[model samples]
Target chain A: MTSNAAGAGTISYEQAGVNYDLIDPLKVAAQRAAAATAGHLAGHGFTEVKASRGESAYVVDVGPFYLASIVECLGSKALVADEMGKLTGRSYYAGIAQDTIAMAVNDLITVGATPLVVQAYWAAGGSDWFGDAQRAQALVEGWKKACDTCGVAWGGGETPALAGIVEGGRIDLAASCTGIIQPKERLSVGDRLGAGDAIVLLASSGIHANGLSLARKLVERLPQGYMTPLADGSLYGEALLAPTVLYSPVTEALERAGVRPHYCANVTGHGWRKLLRHPAQLTYRIDALPRVPEVLRFIQQHAQQDDREAYSTLNMGAGFALFVDAADGQKCVDVARGLGIEAVVAGRVEAGPKQLLIEPLGIRFGDDDLQLR
Target chain B: MTSNAAGAGTISYEQAGVNYDLIDPLKVAAQRAAAATAGHLAGHGFTEVKASRGESAYVVDVGPFYLASIVECLGSKALVADEMGKLTGRSYYAGIAQDTIAMAVNDLITVGATPLVVQAYWAAGGSDWFGDAQRAQALVEGWKKACDTCGVAWGGGETPALAGIVEGGRIDLAASCTGIIQPKERLSVGDRLGAGDAIVLLASSGIHANGLSLARKLVERLPQGYMTPLADGSLYGEALLAPTVLYSPVTEALERAGVRPHYCANVTGHGWRKLLRHPAQLTYRIDALPRVPEVLRFIQQHAQQDDREAYSTLNMGAGFALFVDAADGQKCVDVARGLGIEAVVAGRVEAGPKQLLIEPLGIRFGDDDLQLR
Candidate 1:
């Protein structure tokens, strides 16, 4: 089942047409520029939490509480829904809504913040894109359901009909969430991340939302497209459209149990390499990895991607990762299980060069692979 | 000179290919579906301020404070920057940044909220789009400048490189803001929009982000494209790319002066028709309208649009509108004047059917023109 056995040459994400190498520098520049405007919050009686920049979300210190904010998009996954709808006549927007909400609130929870409200930004290519009542209703219901799942209010949003910038018949979905971390003790900024912390991996529903452009490229090569059957007998696109796992409940559960994570990372664009996102030079050594979802395996096979490339770009199977004290690892897994989520103590933090080592697949991501700090 | 003298006949926004008639129903349906999820806020010790649902932003009552949140985009205005850059060999993203931020924080201040943090969502067509240092630096500097102008923190954001959904070589910019209203009495929910409230008009710099698609289509017919000159001698594209006025300052000034507005509306998209956005059957009579900016007049002349069509589809000159008690009208205008923004008492709210009357131009927008509830 391992993609390493394919013996295919390494296919870097850049080869598939997305080069994070070019984007990281711009992000770094934007962070430095944004940091200069931190003084503006002083007049509002709020202080900027400097360390929150370049992390999953921005944290601001109000008088009585800390607010975490994040703005994220569903990426090109909405196109998957569009293509699937054209083929199956069933709207996959419910999953699209979940993916969009998951992208925002999931990042919010990484800072130990409870999402208070989520506002959506749906930009369509044209006005007639919403003429399909079934599709529109699914989007609305799915957005509300995702909000209910995360226990946040469905704040109002803007739906602009951008006729030219966006492609016709497709919508670019993005959301922003404001979350609150009360008492401030629950904040996970990696200040407490140290050697001997346990690494826990939470199972993903499928590809989640990353590497979708490559996935679509693979679909184009498939003879049957979305109808292509996998070993499990499900259509390729159906498996890819599985609703993202909402990890906010895991954080909420840990808060109720009085367990604080040293750091948390949503395994998204950078895949499992996100496990080493902490600022400190600590190695995340994975002795055991979660089972790769069938959808990801199908993508790797169809895309002819080797293990090192696939693991570095796609979520594989781990949707989220938590670093906590070694003794609390079992309790974290038990909490996730209580909530019907499959989680395991897959690895541990070690005092070494910042890197991620997936021993089973013999895959290693060097420190240079992730340069967010 | 008024565009009505051109005798070019009416040029509806729909004629330029943007039909709000098709988008409004979907928005109405979305509002109804979103209303059902308001109850979820109760679990977080917050109650939904139901009136805020269909307004410019959503308000949530959290303990002693009310929070206002909004998500909005810059529409196709960035395309103007791209096209201008191609012609002028200079980046115009700084103005694009201001327009995006203004679109979000301006709506927030309508409900009397002071912006605390604004997050950005910049989705590019490809990752390398940011490789252009001039464009990236301009976007960063402009975004920071807008944050400083609005007196809010430059919160974190996502810059996803959407390869297909967004047009290549251009970026789609959007922003979301979270603001706080303390002591709750400052909330402006239109309940106080009485018959005698004075209508105050704030001068716009030019076409501030709305109707850009139409503006671009007009450019296609021009002999010189972005270089075409208007009466002011500035290029048509440069005039149209004028940075949007951040009205958060006007609201902040009014709040500091203890002059509460009955209601506020950002004059975008629906243009002057937005003046009748309140759910009351009141007539907004404009005895005097702001002078049309040269950019809008140029558009009207070239597109062969009449005054009725131009004013109803574009801001013309009014950028923001505020309704205050007839007695406090001068004070509100004085507050804006103190901030270096020109404001005038242009009209009065009268008890009648929902409509907008521009006396100087002899134009009227019946209730049928704007159907948003």
Candidate 2:
């Protein structure tokens, strides 16, 4: 219900303690500094993928293959899992681990790379956090399951107990993934995106990994807190704790079908506003929308957000988007279906200003709303 | 001075809220699960080097070359930088960033891999943490400088603001590094380790990214806190915040000289106990010891710790140790000196019990001390 960082006309996310106005500048500065260090790669016989600077992943042009890397953290979602576990007497850490891996691997695959290895970074406030055998076992099992599902080696990790940095009994979960793009032609960063490219959407299970700061904030105002029930009778916190949909397999299926998208967008922190994440100045027009999950509908209703605000701040339904030739849209959807994932041709790109138009919701997001670089 | 987790007969690090007894089993379990997923790499034409599982870095055999990866965090070193910056009117984040980079890159090179790319993970408690342009810019410059120093590309990173998980105004710094090892003979994981190999010690600038939890705790007992001066007249915290040495150059130089060590150990976390980190069961005999840095000497004196506990916990002097042929002992030391890094023929490896014997100090650490796997 709060505005996403990329589209913050309101102060909700700022009130939630994440202010993009202050954070985005630092990102831009880091990008500039990072650009200057590209020359260092050449010494190792690897060239920097110049266009991958602000993309979801950083690509390195190693001979015979391109390597894409990403480092991502699951923001505050574990807090909800902890609270819900206390009330339900069941540990949700398995799902929490899956969500963490999905957050990183999803971003790495955005550059048309196949994830090969994933490393976990789990920092707990105290070592006692792992004394809970069920929780620890669940985390281990989930991490392994996620690696197996994504077809990436569980390439070791670091689990440090950060006493003073993290809050007691709490943890901060993160992961870094390295993927490979072979044959060179598989690389995608929107350079191949055309005006008439069809926009294919892969449905999200729920909130996935973004906007948890606002959702957790909204929980405090509800009388029942996490126990509040939605119209579908699911607990609010449990609904929000749903494991994120891992799209690595979907991308793999498309790769096998040779239906590569010109560009792919992982609908994460920026919500639907991420639809225009590419540097291309094309307009994305969505003629139809997926049914908003009941949990998201409840959040929008309780947060008192209008259609535009809700769509711009949360992944109302779609989680991953792929811009491909109009002829390949249905084929992309069919590939996803083959993997038991729902997908649809949601819209198409047009020759216009850089913006996203959700025609069904009568919502519009201009280029200025989302400035990553 | 407390006992290292690998040799914790005392409860210093435990009192610091990092109880390894509870955390190590979880790590063992995660490693077991990880070992099960090595097959996942075969799908991508990469094979996990089984021996690399419990080592400092994970290695993948990719036919013509091997890729080594490591994930490491700077722990609470940044908290010291934060406090020092507030106390001194100068920001030390550039060094802090370098320390963070060193933590990961140092581990990567232990497998004899030349670092190729490093991705950073900076998780702040709140967005306001980056509002300080000086601190932010210092971090940016430091990261670029460190990447340039290591000759690796500054791959993209993620900066998340986790308000509830991380402490307010604090940040958790971690990084993942991917490196290359060509010719396959360059890989060193103790398989080549043998008796009579000389032990070469690389002098640490100071405490390099380990035992910081206890170091930060000891500050509470000091009346002047971080401002307390050492015998050498340097501020206690500033010395503690000194940048960790980047050992990548030493490894590179040794490689260029065609003098590959049988094994290398980044003396971290476990202190001198890390000297025998290789699983060869050989006794490591140290006849000479490097002069302990003044700051570490001050820590031992103030904390009322004897030589045994101090050496078992803090770096005591040597930051890195390499085991090689007796003929190459002085050559290794000379290589480090050529790069402006002090080194000495500190010890030798013997075909004896699995233990570390500090000859001058009459100290002995049995095999039971350190249990990484």
Candidate 3:
């Protein structure tokens, strides 16, 4: 933070390092403590700018148009081996980039935002040179491929090396996307919604990406056939991995059908509860609900968890949810089903203060301070 | 972190809570642990997107540009303050963004590129609401101003909340930046530099965001005046917080004059040693270097360090370096000095392995042995 040949507007990075102009010797000493790392600086080949910094500040123009959003995922399933036993498992970190890309693009579909560049980060415990390099190159390639799948281009991304900060062989993949919408076509929270609006449920591929930490914990403590039963009754890690479902086709169908949803969201973490964040005072009545899959039942029964907790955490077999007028609802569902998803009319919208009532499941969510707060 | 009935994506902020996904059965316990701190998520209206995503990806529209490189001051400047009895200090957290953005952009400038956005993040610590929010806002505002000054735009950024993973009141700012450049207009690192090339030093502030952990330890044990003196005669904190000199104007002139350099780099940690990262195998000989500032002299005298060690670990007044042809060497120096920065016909380019040898400073640095193994 010390400046030489200083004048006004001559700021530097030291101030940003948390070192003030206070006269304390020990503070300087403390800041220098981590300089003894084992790895050497990346060899000066052709001016290797750090990948992390490059991703943050560098903007590229591959084509025209105010591009679209960037979608990404952390490939939590990769952590199965990372958090559990590393030896008795396979080493495939490449799928994470694809999953991360899928997660980002899926969100893009909701906003009608086309994606452009997809980026990610990969962290490892001990740098397995061959393995790590393969994973890095493969991850970038997969992300690019996924962006292409969404009919977009993958600009660039980052792969930083944080040696000591992250220890247990963990590489977290998170993404930030940017997209645009025609001002008139943009969706807002308070779009008009009447009483006769219908709810459409898109079938889920088991548990999806959320609630795995709890599911694994509960399954690990349950009986052999408790979570994922096999022929003779065994566990199912694949069931838990349930590759993320993308609704790009649904986007196409809805657009072609000229259907405009009053409200929409990707049923990800906490499933139906995510809808509440729209911040409107409306009651959702589920007179007819989608069938719950076996995986969720196993998790609930084995963990002895209540229905509220389960609904607030797992997908409950519905990958996505949409609320449209009753007149257009059947058509939307038909179009979704035509696109291969098990879409069906499930519920309706009513007047209330942000409440969700399920008479059949005997579940009354949203009003309980225990849940909302 | 969640999705809803309508296909348009929306989610409640609470759904994105780290533990909302059953990552911890003892979520209540975990939430309780995360509670009782400042730095809480501040609710604010998200900025409206002003451009398209595709073209928006690269904000740069034309040919010539510049760059800055950034890396978090991983050293314990914060710990040094904690040891000094000021645990609640806003600390140097905000300053990290400056370096992070600089680190990214400086590289772009080395090859001649213009920055687009300055994005950064911090791993959340004790939920210090006021402290965290103020710092967060300050960081964004600072970055926005920096980009604005440089004729670049500031795209939105990320801020992750990690409670238990980090230490008490400590946050790690992960910075990334994106920039742009034209293929033809980019400054190729292969310009002619005969035996009389100029190696100009764009003076540095003390430890401008690097090698702080070791610095604090050594400075703490020194007698006095061993660091920058603060507004109130405090000798410790001010020097470390001194900001780095930005090399924006000097490089801009080079581009304007169409003076492509044989090599260039932001003088950060490892000082002249990092110059070898440049392409073109030649001996970069520096002469008539500027006087080492008091900050470095203090560290040298107090730590009983040699000039080589001092420059190796500290910028010693030079924040950015360049290698221009002997033909344009004087012009380069004249242009730099005209811009109020002291420059010298400091070096030459001779046939040899790509390397940097500052004979006057008695130092040698290169990117030869530290290959990615």
lDDT of 2 by residue, B78-139 (tens): 88888898899899999999999999998998888999889989999889998989999999
Per-residue error at B366 for model 1, in Å?
A: 3.9
Candidate 3 structure quality by residue, lDDT tens digits, A1-373: 2332222222221211222232122222211221111011111112211211112121222232222322234434555534323433433444455566556556655544333333343333223321444444555555554544444333323333232333334554555444333222433223555567887888876676666555555544544422346333434554555556667567656866877676565676556675453445778788776767667676666555567667766778777777777888889888988877788787888887777776677877675422211
**Tens digit of per-residue lDDT, candidate 2, span A1-373:** 3454334334354566678878888898898888888998877777988889889999988787887887889989999999998999899999999999999999998999998889989999889898998999999999999988999998889899887899999999999888888768889987999799999999999999888887887876778999999998999999999999999999988988989889999999778999989888899999978778888888787766788778878999999999998999999999998888889899999999999999988899999888778
lDDT of model 3 at residue A334? 86
Q: What lDDT is reached at residue B281 by model 2?
A: 78
User: DockQ of every model listed?
Assistant: 0.73, 0.81, 0.04
lDDT-superior candidate, 2 or 3: 2
TM-score of chain A of each: 0.95, 0.96, 0.70
In model 1 chain A, the worst 10-residue window by lDDT is A1-10
Residue A343 CA displacement from its true place in model 1, Å: 1.1
TM-score of decoy 3: 0.60
Q: Report the poorest 10 consecutive residues by lDDT, candidate 2 chain A.
A: A2-11
Q: Where in model 2 is the C-alpha error above 4 Å?
A: A1-11, B1-11
